[model samples]
Target: MISPTTIDQVFETARVEEVIGDFVQLKKAGSNFKGLSPFSDERSPSFMVSPVKQIWKDFSSGKGGNVVAFLMEHEHFTYPEAIKYLAKKYNIEVEETEQTNEQKEQQDERESLYLVSEFANSYFQKILHKTDQGKAIGLSYFKERGFTEDTIKKFDLGYSLDEWQAFTDEALKQGYKLEFLEKTGLTIVKEDKRFDRFKGRVMFPIKSMSGRVLGFGGRILINDKKAAKYVNSPESDIYHKSKVLYGIYHAKQSIAKEDNCYLVEGYTDVIQFHQTGIKNVVSSSGTALTPEQIRLINRLTKNITVLFDGDAAGMRASLRGIDLILEQGMNVKVCTFPEGEDPDSFAKQNTLEELSVYLIENAKDFIQFKASVLYEESKNDPIKKAETIRDIVNSISKIPDRIKKEIYIQECSKIMDISEEVLFSTLAQINKKDFKEADKQYKTEQRAFEVIKQQPVKKVDVQYVLERKIIEVLLLYGNRTEGFEDLILKENDKGQLILEPVINRAKVFEKIFLDLQDDEMEFTNPKFKTLYYTIIDTLNQNPEFQLKNFINSVDTDMANEITTILMEDERYALDDWERMHIFPKEKTQNVAQLVTETILSLRCFLIDQKVKEVQQKTIENKNNVNKSVLEEVKDYSGLKMLLSRKLNRAL
Candidate 1:
């Protein structure tokens, strides 16, 4: 029940680029920004943002919208959640009006989970700073790890007490429902008893791309051998651990700025790097990196620098993630720390400048990293070495970029002491196998869909004709002097009267639409009724309704439709090209220019026809009309006279 005024404030202050750039890395493309499409798999960027219009369009997926619309599309955020997120970002105060119980019940489940998670975040943070147990345990743990007060607070780090019901009791005291607490994995319920799940653990809160708290990761301080060293909140409506990357919310801006992200293994590693001023860092929290997580980082930066411990097992686990990153078309570099150290310890041992230098000097491309590591594992047996080279080439072939693949192939051949042609042949074989399997899967899905009687998808970008007609009318009549047109009807003697055109744009549209009613003129695609009404209503509201604003405001389907039409009929580029060629025509420059004059004359003829209408109307309304109408008539007459002079000169 947020007030309309509060909602409007959130919407008005929420910049589309700021919101989208959190999840997608955008670089300047002409007047707009472009990034890889979040909705599909691709190597090249197809997402576009226009700051002038405050809208974004994903050309690959055909989705476009304002900030709110993007949240809805990408995160499946409800309208209220999207607004509240923007409010939190921009620091706008939300004023909610009271809602009835039934009305409150109608709120979406995911939104409630978000609210519960947010409440849990505040609860954990409060425990860390305010409660004795939290202060002694979580705060002490982070401090012992060499985290400064500002660093801890900046990341919203917190602690949960060792008491069984400490967090659950406080959450319940604050009127948070046990059901939702359990749903968000903040509380564990067993056989009619409930308790805090993160007791005795130092808290590391996980955040959404927009920086909203979604869940937490916690580490144990006790020496219980039976207990896991670290535990994280289970998957919930708001948090999907496999799909989440810790510190991404905090590091997105820096990652985008640097055009790279530094991947680490744990929460402390991320914090230590940030403390050292290497800000573009995130962690998978020691789990196997999923494609979903890789895609999330891919949205922020194409290049990833994986900093893993130099242990053998660590290198093997990381190699698996490397292939996943390559499959997503991301550029990956590996930076292994010393055998005895992790990122947290290593970063703590060095200053920011030293760490930066170490990273720069040690980083290796994926192929080299893979070949070097696997070659060591293979112990230089020529047969095993050859197999290792093929394995490395397989990873290289997964990369979608042709240039990158070629470069890696050359590097791999040199490293393995093999022929480049042989490696290329191996890569080609792997690529063919991958594509055949992919095509087979696609055909299987198509067959299944056919059995379900699903209709085949019609071709995309095929309905330019209808869109062109709409644009044609808008350009011709947007600001014209418009009035209602009268049509003839049968009289008593079966006589008829003439029809007249309308001066009002809305009325002209209405007349045109009515005339086309029996013709059943189709727009060639289905649209939501509300969106259709919105477009029509906007055109009806403004006498000078520019097609650009309306077109930009709608979804991608309509915007693409309008842009295609506007660009299709206008040969402005060629027109200028021909105009510039005037003197090059040998001794026939006059004839070349005369043809251009003919088109200009026809344009004037159309304008003069409208000018005569206004002039006739001016005479009829001489005594009753406003003075502005007379001025408009004079302007039109002068324009017509100028055109007439041009016509005479050309003749």
Candidate 2:
């Protein structure tokens, strides 16, 4: 647990844009920064970060919150992990809330896996630097590959001892559970026996986007005929190889700054490129291309350059990955090294300038690369040439943008000596059957492009809306002292109960609290009700209260609700709201009227709800209806009518 003071300081110092900008590419949109939703794959920007309000909202995924919440949601971090991450980023010393031994033991499984992996990473580094065998074998292997000491330490390269039980015995002796160590795949425990999983191997720590070590990739130094050369941590709670990109933790900033990601196949390829002063490179970490991996890069940039070793046969097979990139609507360029040179060997052989110059001079667009390779393979055979054209056209069809597709098709026609009409026809045929499965799934359903056609619209919850408005007013202007027309239930000359306006000067929160107390009413929605209590209680205690403490102390999910209430106007224009045929009642310039109208609307809605409830029971009754129920409905209806009249609206 983190102490309250430190948590408050984190929320105060961590700017929402600065934090989210590390993950999502945000551009200025009015007072807010907007970008594509990292939670969803969309072409347009709907994710918004508000620096002024210090919150973010992914409208596509409905995930909205403050900075800490963003980390917890995006990176799947625990609350403490998120706080500590922010504390480290901003140089704030975290004041921790002490936990009992039992509380510490009760930590969740995923966090335990993370902790074990962290321990393994730190232990590996210790062995690589401290032990004679590690410095001689693992350090020697990395040094032989031309990696400098700084580069080796930056990537946290390390070596596990050659002995089978070396790491397992050490971990157990350190009080780590065998279950977690085994589950994290750092140790293999079976049949009352345990051993190191990465025995006698150089360590490659696989990390999440936020830099936490998730798993490890290990390489054996002495290649035995029967033994495998490389081994990676099996899929655990934290490590999903398909979704993890090696070096993304270090490459994210450079990728965003350069607006390009250099993708390679192996860990060495990524490291070699980074060593050459090209920092925006990541590897698929030996896995085949995946949409999930591409989307990770997509969050940072829309451009990728696939760098392949000089193996032409390998490049031909790897060309399939370019289609996946094209499907993601990315601008892709492909570059291969000179024959007999991989990224690792080529990078080690050349200076940074040489590697940089070679890439710029040789990089080709996806269409050109695909066409050149396939065309060369086609030779003088007519049938082979025709198949090559179709293959190139298929790649073009993968592009989602029509304009880009046409441009690629035109380029293909010029390269293949084919007509644009022929290429277009081929593309249309390829794309026509692309959605066949989706069409079958949605045959009876409404088309997605058409938002609502025959589907029924959900009825608005009147009371819920009113409750939100009440919360919104309190969040915006709760402490402001204003003259209010306090409606008092009084009897006129005829002795019948009627409402009269009694003038009073009071804080807005005090007025709303008193009225709700007088009516013995509470918010009908749980989310809104909890928020109302928090805001009212805080404002009542200190009339000069600022929103920083309130927003900071609230639960993360509640922060979304708070932003939804506080930043409603950021989403819509009040000036043009009437054009949509909905009149704006609350959030007016006059704070008193905004507060008064919201409370009145809520009262009217609650009264209406009560009358409906009474009427429902009256209809369900088989015996004579209770006289009290009928009077209750009539009296609530009369009060609703009076409140409606005061609001100058008809019920």
Candidate 3:
């Protein structure tokens, strides 16, 4: 468990903008920061960060919270993991109480896998720098490849020893369960024996975007004809190769800053580029590019520059990737190095200045590169040329933006000596075919959804609105002091009863609590009831209660609810309603009135429910002609009328 002081310090030291900015590219919008929703695929900005409030809200997905809550929602982190992430980010010392043996044994499987991966990363690094055998082979190999000591350390490169049980024995002796080790694919267990998976290989720790060591990619040092050169960690609870990109953790900031990403292949390609002063680059770890990986890059920028090897095979291999990039609505450019060299070798051979200039001058837009490359193969055959033109037109049709598609069409027309009219007509046919297929899929899904909707569902709670309103008022204006007026029935000096209006100043929370108690009202929703009491307790315990602090103390679900309520109001504030001549009334001005009205409305609703119950009873007993039941129904109906009158509603 993390110490309360450390958690509080994390909340105080971490800024919402700075923390969220690491994941989403936020641009300044008035006093707050706005960005495309990281939680959804959006063109316009719906994710807003409020520095003043230390919270964020994704208007698209309706997920909102403070710094820790954002991490828990976005990164799928537990409470302590989120806190530790922030502590590491801000360089704050984390003070955690040691877990007991029972607590350690109860850790979840996924967290255990993560711990094993992290431990493996540390162990491999220790072997690389501290041991003689590691330095003689793994460290020397990196040095021979032109990797500097700083580059190797920055990327956390390491070497696994040659012995089969070298890693497995150490990990098992260190109290890591063999089950997690086998699950993470770090240890391969047979009938009765276990061995290290990446033995005698140089290790590259593959990290998630948040910089957690998800897994590793190891390159075998010794040259053997029968063995594969590189092997990667298998899919596990913490790592998915299809969904991860090598060096994304290191490249994300630069990708956002430069507003572009240089997509390469292999781990060394990414590291070499970063070492050569090109920091905004990531690799697919030698696997074919995937839509999941493309979306990962799409979260940061819409521009991707794919760096390909100069060989013909490399060029041909990358054509499908270009189409994939186009399909994601990204502006893709291709940069091929000199003949016989890849990004890793090319970067190692040239100075940063030369390589940088070459990339800028030689980079060609995807359409142009595709045309030029295909023209060479089709120059002799008219049939092949026509097919190439059709292929290019098909690629152009995949672009989502109409303006960009038109622009690409015009460029393709110029390059292929074809008319824009013909290209546009071809694009229209492709789009029509696409639309028909998409419409077919939509109908199929709609039919399924309609069938599901026919099933009976419990009716939504009608008291939800009033309950939510009560919570919202407390969250927004709970700490503000307001004057409340109440009617008191008192005995006068002449021994006659008289109603006197008394005014008193009290916090909004105090006023709402007293008003609800007077009517014996309670929240209907279980979650809302818990939240209401938690807020009241927080306000009572600390006179200077802050919503952000209160948010940090609650669990993830309740915190998200509180932030949603608090941010629902701020969403309109972001619209700057005052400038639009829409002067909204402040709730604080009539806190007492709002509280009384809300409580009265709830009472009226409850009375109406009771009257309906009695009316139902009277109907059920109608055949028997029960006089007492009819009289009870009449009394409940009259009570409902009085409650309605209190709310100024006509019965």
Residue 184 error for model 1, in Å? 1.7
What total of clashing residue pairs does each candidate reach?
5, 0, 0
lDDT of 1 by residue, 1-651 (tens): 688888778766878888898889887654467788889977677677766556677766767666777888887777677787789989999998665645544667776677677777777788899988888878888888999999999999888888899888877776667888899888999999988888888888898777777888888899999988898889887788888899988899999889999999899999999998999999998788999899888888889999989798778867888989988888899999888998999999999999999999999988778877888878658888878888898888888889989998888878888899998888888888988999999999999978877766667442343344444454334334344322223344446442332233334345444434543543444542343345556767876675545653566566555444433322222233344564223212233233324333444544566678877887897877788877876887666665555456532
Tens digits of lDDT, candidate 2, 375-487: 88796999999999999888888888989988889999998888999988888788778878667768747566366755787999988888888888788778888888867
Across 468-553, the per-residue lDDT of candidate 3 in tens digits comes to: 98999888789988777666669999999765779899998998898788778878789999999999998999998987787877
Q: Candidate 2: misplaced stretches above 4 Å?
A: 1-3, 95-104, 444-458, 481-506, 515-521, 556-590, 607-646
**Clashing pairs in model 2, backbone N/Cα/C closer than 3 A:** none
lDDT of each: 0.75, 0.86, 0.87
What TM-score does prediction 2 earn? Answer: 0.87
lDDT comparison, 1 vs 3, better candidate: 3
Runs in model 3 deviating more than 4 A are: 27-50, 57-64, 97-105, 452-460, 483-504, 568-597, 610-651
